[model samples]
Target: MAVQALKDYKFSPADAQEKFHGAQLLYVGWDEHLMFCAPFAYCLPPNTLFSDLCQKFMAHSFGYHPDWKSVDFSKVTWLKSGQPWQPDMSKTLAELGLKHKDVLRFQTPGLKGINGTCS
Candidate 1:
């Protein structure tokens, strides 16, 4: 049922595997007194099917309080993407230099050496 609702959702991704392949629940809203669904579901996307299961679990889990009127589901956010991991300049350059001793010109072959190095 919840899965169907997710599919019907506008922002929800179609074909969970493709769009939400690496989708992860960054943080599940926690209910202090344990009012609803434990308010927590931090889990790694093991597989595509697991992703769907997770979505199903998150969509509708009002546990003890199953009130459609009193419940506030305004904070259920699917944090699929995370902070961009910036490459360490020093490490990256060092690795690159070590990996490829010959740094080919990014441009075309004819312009290999536009300077005096060209034969």
Candidate 2:
């Protein structure tokens, strides 16, 4: 039963692995205290926009309910290699010097901006 449940899990990455082969796999996380949440691994396309990635994180990590739409994109900030990730001012992942398994920290609205370390 447990194995079957794992197979049916909503966030399964089996398909994504096949589809995004050779794509950079980035670890995205919402900065949280007490380690209450888990970071998401994304198979980011080479030309994916920063804004689009932010939206995708919100939708997938937080769920796509009607209430999620009210969240402001302006307050969304990402940190890569300890530097701020600007959506409007940045280019693609490859252009931004991001490699596979790079961890990007996300600072969301209403959450105190605290950097969390991934082991």
Candidate 3:
């Protein structure tokens, strides 16, 4: 469906990349983990390494979960902006082609939330 505007509605997006000082907005979600309810957003530099993202940021964000420690990054599947993506852990976000407002989702093959209830 197309948006029906009463007038020429045009303005800069409030969450545009320029709004963030040297950082880009990125969203990350853990598949089947309803415990988080939704993806977490972060304002980070494009040069942030993928390894740091998993070991630092992600660890800080989802470490409290019972399944967190069991998750193996090597076995985890990834999706970038809703499409399958194979990322190099040593590469930076920019090197992986991630851009502002990109959504990254990961699934731990055997670890679905507690009891597989998705939470």
**Candidate number with greatest lDDT:** 3
TM-score to native of every candidate shown? 0.23, 0.57, 0.92
Candidate 3 lDDT tens digits, 1-119: 65689998778889889889989988999999989989999889999999999999999999999999999998999998788999999999999888999999999988979898989
> In candidate 3, which residue ranges exceed 4 Å CA deviation?
1-7
Q: What is the lDDT of residue 101 in candidate 2?
A: 71
Rank order (by lDDT, best first) = 3, 2, 1
lDDT of each: 0.32, 0.62, 0.93
Which of 1 and 2 is the better model by TM-score? 2
Task: Please give, for residues 1-119, the per-residue lDDT of candidate 1 as tens digits.
Answer: 45466355556554443354454333344222233333454333433242333345544542333332232333222222232222222332223221111111111122212132431
Tell me which residue pairs clash in candidate 1.
Answer: 29-39
Q: Model 1 residue 69 lDDT?
A: 29
- Candidate 3 yields a Cα-based lDDT of 0.93
Least lDDT summed over 10 consecutive residues: which range in candidate 3?
Answer: 1-10
State the lDDT at 88 in candidate 3: 98
- Cα deviation of 77, candidate 1, in Å: 13
Candidate 3 has which clashing residue pairs, if any?
none
